[model samples]
Target: MEHIVELVGRALLAFLIMMVIARLLGKQTIAQMTYHDFVAAITLGALTANLAFNVQMKIGHMITVLLTFTVIAYLLMILALKNRSLRKWISGQPTMIIQNGKILEGNMRKLKLSLDTLNQELRERNIYNIEEVQFAVLELNGEISILRKPEYLPVTRKDLKLKAGRQWFPIELIMDGKIIQDNLRQNNLTIEWLMSQVQKKGLTIAQVNYAVKSSNGQVYFDRYDDQMPNPIDKE
Candidate 1:
């Protein structure tokens, strides 16, 4: 029917318009959205939805409003970037909630960041013990940035005064029973050497579901039939 065709056309138009506007807006990630960006995003989504289904409004008028709103948001974003005070107001300043293993209850109350939320965020960053946190700041984009006490930090090779081990990048030699000829050639390996490696493990190229050769020249294999009684990860 004509109505169905019109709806389809409008939906496609909405998609194209959103794609263009998104490029113009230059949003890198939803997680990085400021308060103004968040509001603009919601407004854009609503406008696009209306453009898709609200047949009562004139399409030209609908597009005009959407484009106008986007221009205003874009201009505001540009101005926010140039002015430090405006940026601070729009994005909000990062607030420190934890310092020297002590929770700042005053900052928490002012930012309306709940203790439960703080604990959850800390756990997400693998900081199980709050007493060990050296510093924790609530970022503008609702992410918690934490610095652990030096004592709680993981030991590094430099600390032990030991040379770093050879870094070996794994190269795929076989996948889905097919030999990766390009990888073999790049790694200076031949089919004969590959077959011998497979045979050492009492398997053939046909038996391997996947295979990889480490830079250390160690070849590993995975078979088609794992014969697992119960995969622990299966829900």
Candidate 2:
């Protein structure tokens, strides 16, 4: 009974620690993890499992090791974000697999991406004919991004001679009840303006789940309690 209780306690501790560490590590899905991120994830998983089951090892010692590794990994990620060259070195640059309907055999050799695999990826994107590809890049995350030839490209608003609304990158002003000061400053906005906007919406910043400055410099808010009637997902 004591052994079982100890095991359960260890599992719960490991689970909580892993959750906290994962949140601190940032939000990159398995498909988006870079090489370093992948290595860190594997290492962390091993350490977490050992922390739960390795009764021979002292828990404090194992936790210390795990935390130290997490710190190193976090610091590396921060440095990578700030340093473009370092980021490229860590995550690697995208490789051009196809250009102007011509396959880059040498580049594919370097990536070890077989023609069969390339064809498979292209087919998944509904590009059955490689000749239609103007440019196909193998991204660092092992996904292929393809640009169709101009002639093969889909018709857009311009093709129909229709006016289109200008698009802008959405800037986060508030996320998870916290103001994004840097983003606000980047857009030459002030807290007074942000507060006034929130006030107009009958909300305080604390009550907002997220807020963004979108197209035509409009502020969009998503409150924590949306108060929608019968939401589509019904969650």
Candidate 3:
């Protein structure tokens, strides 16, 4: 019983320490975490696990080790931010893998990236044909950034000298038979207006599984029942 109590107490202490350390480190998404950050995370996790279950180990000594690592990581982050050279050394730099529709074999070889992987990355970005890509850069985070030839780019309204109105995202007016009054008020819409739109579609608030009001004052709805024919089939 004493061993179990010690285990639980140590686990709780480790959890608190981890939370405090993480808060000090600030926010970093999985994709944004640098190589150093990744290593620190893994090391801290290992130490915390050992602290939790390793009764033979001293709790105070384990905490000191964990805090030491956290302090070092935090200091490194500060130094990297202040020193550009250190930043580059820590995270590396983006490598140009493709230039002028031609692959840079030397760069690819240095990065240990295969031709098949390059082709797969291109296809993921919807550029199956290498001729369409003017430049492709492999970022330090393992993401590929592509630049297409000017001629292959999509034509925009400004390119055709056509005036386009400002675009707005659709607002959810109702969800799961509940009226979103907050959204309606923010968008300057009324319950009566929403009711009319639902009636036009031969639906009630309860019947509507989801509903959104488009920027152009159009209300789209999905009914709870699947009795309606598929719009794809109609098309």
Relative to the true structure, candidate 3 reaches a TM of 0.71
Model 2 per-residue lDDT tens digits across residues 61-127 = 9899999999988988888889999989876788898988899999999888899999999999999
By lDDT, is 2 or 3 better? 2
Count clashes in each candidate, considering only residues at least 3 apart in sequence or on different chains: 0, 0, 0
lDDT of 1 by residue, 94-128 (tens): 89999888999999999888999999998988877
Off by over 4 Å in 1: 165-235
Query: Candidate 3 lDDT, tens digit per residue, 1-235?
Result: 9989999999999899999989888786245677678778899999999999899999989999999999988988887789999988865678999999889999999999999999999899888888999999998778889999998999999999999887678999889879999999998989999999999988888899899977875788988886867545653
lDDT agreement with native, every candidate: 0.89, 0.89, 0.88
Residue-level error in angstroms, candidate 3, position 146: 0.8
Name the top TM-score candidate: 1
Between prediction 2 and prediction 3, the one with superior TM-score is 3
Model 3 whole-model lDDT (C-alpha atoms): 0.88
Give the lowest summed-lDDT range of ten residues in model 1.
27-36
Q: Which residue runs of candidate 2 sit more than 4 Å off their true CA positions?
A: 29-31, 163-235
